[model samples]
Target: PKRKTVEKHGRDLRDIIGQQQGKRALEIAAAGNHNLLFLGPPGTGKTMLASRLCDLLPEMSDEEAMETASVASLTQSEINEHNWKSRPFRSPHHSSSMAALVGGGSVPRPGEISLAHNGLLFLDEMPELDRKVLDSLREPLESGEIIISRAQGKTRFPARFQLVGALNPSPTGYYEGNQARTNPQAILRYLGRLSGPLLDRFD
Candidate 1:
């Protein structure tokens, strides 16, 4: 059964046009459980490729599937009898606040990363995210879990999932060397939204 699943995934990968490099990177990331960053212009299938990663991954163990479903249930994520076994692939908007990504409130709850346990957490247009929100992931990325502390107590959520981020090379979504590109100073500031420390967490 597992072999058939992996074979089906391989066939799906073969259907992607061009981007041999992207396929190789995906293989490496999946094999080594490495975090990945995709920098490219729009319409390049960055999001599409990231979404297919879960399909390539091995089927979840029974315990892993159950734990993942529990988090989904806790987050009130529209769970039903079917589709509960599907591994999560959460992509919160760039405007999401630190609390939204990391989980916090008068009543603590699992955030996107937690909800993505045993699966993938994709951040598209990564630099558009608030620096603090991006930075909040640093610890959890390393620790493979998140601890949300409320006034009452702390709740821990599993976050041992692969991280995949996609971003355009420049704010203009075009080649940086283009004549009409934003000035160097402006470009630097734009990219600076992703701080050095936060980027350090990604492989």
Candidate 2:
């Protein structure tokens, strides 16, 4: 497919104010393809920071572009020529199912992680997701690909994408401060929804 020239526009890191640590972390993640997690209160620009990480990423190589486009073509009707060479940025909602996050069905279609191949996967409100759904990502995060097996057959999809996650420190979106509404025990349980192994995957 002939690639079209498209003007890329996105949130600039420069426009965000007063998050030196977050900005630095984004730079490091972009440079090394590291998985990242942002923990803070609500309305702290965690999602904003995650969204802009893609802008900092370098252009996809031809091979990478083809790999990413191929996965997208499976789910989308057509790949936009102007964005064919661009890296994918998939942000599945916190309530996504295991199949939705990883990939599954009677026919085994690619999921958000697969579609984000060679690009980025942003998970906002990370701890709010079902534990099972989040843990399903463990293998792919380490192996750079996912294998879907069904009674009829098995299929594999590439999933080598950087993961960026954001979440509040507590259920009420506050923690260990004067305005905190949730108790320490409840807060621990809320954050505990993310298993140790899953949390270990992030830098």
Question: What do the candidate models score in CA lDDT, each in turn?
Answer: 0.82, 0.89
- In model 2, residue pairs whose N, Cα or C atoms come closer than 3 Å (at least 3 residues apart or on different chains), thus clashing, are none
lDDT of 2 at 175: 68
RMSD for each of the candidates: 2.8, 3.0
The number of the candidate with the highest TM-score is 2
lDDT of candidate model 2 versus the reference: 0.89
For model 2, residues 106-169, the per-residue Cα lDDT tens digits are 8899999999899899999998899888889999999999999988878999999999999899
**True-vs-predicted CA distance for residue 71, candidate 1, Å:** 0.7
**Cα lDDT of model 1 by residue, 1-203, tens digit:** 55533223223477899988888888888888888999888889899888878777776778988898888888778753554555677899999988789887788888889988998999999999988888889888889899988778888888888899999877888664554367778778878888888788778
